[model samples]
Target: MKKAYRIKKDKEFQLVFQKGASFANRQLVIYYLEKKDQQHFRVGLSVSKKIGNAVTRNQVKRYIRQAFIDLENRIKDNYDIIIIARNPVKDMDYHEIKKSMQHLFYKTELYK
Candidate 1:
């Protein structure tokens, strides 16, 4: 995902966490806040150190980002979304991650 399409700052993540509605499955958790003035959606990803070492965390993040990129066209545009990876995600592959994310989006009605 591009920098413009990502939530990179701590404040932004906190805003989403505090103000947004959340949805989750066993593998992933999602927090989303509608941003009516924004032209497109932006996403933030979180993978705790408790989930793995550096390489594993980075790999999980990459998978999540790629999943978002693939779903960009189908996802609602006027929201800020944050995805938090849970422990079960460490064993999941890219396809599984994507599917789990899709489930969250569908559950939240963010998927078009």
Candidate 2:
């Protein structure tokens, strides 16, 4: 299943990037911010052109989306999350990508 888009506010994105906090696990960089509702976790993916051409960027987004889809319901609420693709992602395999994202999210306190 595809995960729904829940992050639509620039303010929320800013908070996650500027104030929320971040963690990296060799597979993904996660930025997350807490909220009041505890049940409203939203996620976004960012794979810039700097990462690659359209194909690579879309591939990165797809991987992030698929991973998040499996874990979204289990994540903590009232938070917005952004996944930043790194150079490390360019060469990693699919499972490695998923594991990295999972590990990073847990490290960022979004999974618990």
Candidate 3:
């Protein structure tokens, strides 16, 4: 498990948990709340069984984590980004997955 602050119990996460506002040509339900003493950003990958079995879900999580690692060096900001995996992601390639996250950050104005 990743050692980082979790938004699991945060009110903002729950409030923005629903499908709503979108950006980067993608429909993302984002909750942007501030965090102090957060030395780094932590990403939470949310994969549901509706997308696939345990293996498939874990694969997506791994892919998301790798994508984050690749971008972490270039990414600048403080956030607890939780990516909810959509069914379409199961068929998407790594580049697409990476771009989706990068776009999300860009759209959210999290990138400097």
Q: Who wins the lDDT comparison?
A: 1
TM-score of 2: 0.83
- Order of the predicted models by TM-score, top scorer first: 1, 2, 3
Q: List TM-scores for all candidates, in order.
A: 0.98, 0.83, 0.74
What would the TM-score be for candidate 1 when compared with the true structure? Answer: 0.98
lDDT of 3 by residue, 1-112 (tens): 3556345555545544443233434422333543555677765556779878888888887887788778886655565566777788777778888888887877777675
Query: RMSD of each candidate?
Result: 0.6, 2.2, 3.4
Question: Which 10-residue span in candidate 2 carries the lowest summed lDDT?
Answer: 1-10
Which pairs clash in the backbone of model 1?
Answer: none
Model 1, position 55, has a per-residue lDDT of 98
- lDDT of the candidates, in the order given: 0.94, 0.75, 0.65
The parts of candidate 1 lying over 4 Å away from their true place are none
lDDT of residue 92 for candidate 3 = 76
Give the per-residue Cα lDDT of candidate 2 at 88. Answer: 73
Top of the candidates by TM-score: 1
**Residue 86 Cα positional deviation in candidate 1, in Å, after optimal superposition:** 0.3
